[model samples]
Target: MFAPMDSTEIFWVATICVLLAVELATLGLTTIWFVGGALIALAAYECGAGMPLQLILFTCV
Candidate 1:
């Protein structure tokens, strides 16, 4: 089994998945940016970033 993920990790992962799905479905290159942001945010979270920092990374990445 996989290690348990915290809510923050789950949220970022879910966001990435949903955005990826939307990008795949549309192929319009819209949600792709958000997907990158989500990925960065997830990385930041894994690096022990705080919620505010994670949100900032998600928005400004």
Candidate 2:
């Protein structure tokens, strides 16, 4: 049996993708910073950080 990714992981990844897409489409710096934060949170999620920790890192980044 293959298990799917958790909801949190899915959301974070989706957020990262969407942010990158929007940033690229606009070629703007606004969302780039957010993309950095989202990437950090996504990495943290992959490293097994909890939601609260992810949110904190996202905000700090």
Candidate 3:
């Protein structure tokens, strides 16, 4: 099955969600930022942005 949105965005968001859930379930600080970063990348991709911009956004957030 395929996502309704761009493939890159779908995968990244799914990965983000998975990471976030795991982080929450485990109560660990680790890996949450990476998941957030992926979410940032996914949003950037959907917005027609580039990797550099997404990285910047993720780092700043």
Candidate 4:
């Protein structure tokens, strides 16, 4: 069985995946920043940051 993951974690992971797919399909590199942002948000979530903090990290990173 897969390891249990929080819904927020799944959301960030899915965001990263979709952004990556879009970046690959277009190769325009625009979504790369979003991928980085999602990664930061994921890390923040793993560190138990609140949604507001996670969002700030996502936007600032």
The RMSD (Cα, Å) of candidate 3 is 3.4
- The top-ranked prediction according to TM-score is 1
Best of the two (1, 3) by lDDT: 1
Best by lDDT: 4
Residue 20, candidate 1: Cα error in Å is: 0.4
Better of 3 and 4 by TM-score: 4
Could you tell me how far off, in angstroms, the CA of residue 23 lies in candidate 4 after the best superposition? 0.3
What tens digits encode model 4's per-residue C-alpha lDDT throughout 1-61? Answer: 9879978999999999999999999999899999999999999898889999999988887
Instruction: Rank by lDDT, highest first.
Output: 4, 1, 2, 3
What TM-score do all the candidates reach, one by one? 0.91, 0.83, 0.63, 0.91
The candidate with the higher TM-score, 2 or 3, is 2
lDDT of 2 at 22: 96
Q: What is the lDDT of candidate 3?
A: 0.79
Give the per-residue lDDT digits (tens) of candidate 1, residues 1-61: 8899988898999999999999999999998999999999899889988989988988986
lDDT at position 36, candidate 2: 91
Where model 3 places Cα greater than 4 Å from the true spot, the runs are: 1-3, 50-61
- Candidate 1 local lDDT, residue 35: 94
Report how far off residue 21 is in candidate 2 (Å).
1.5
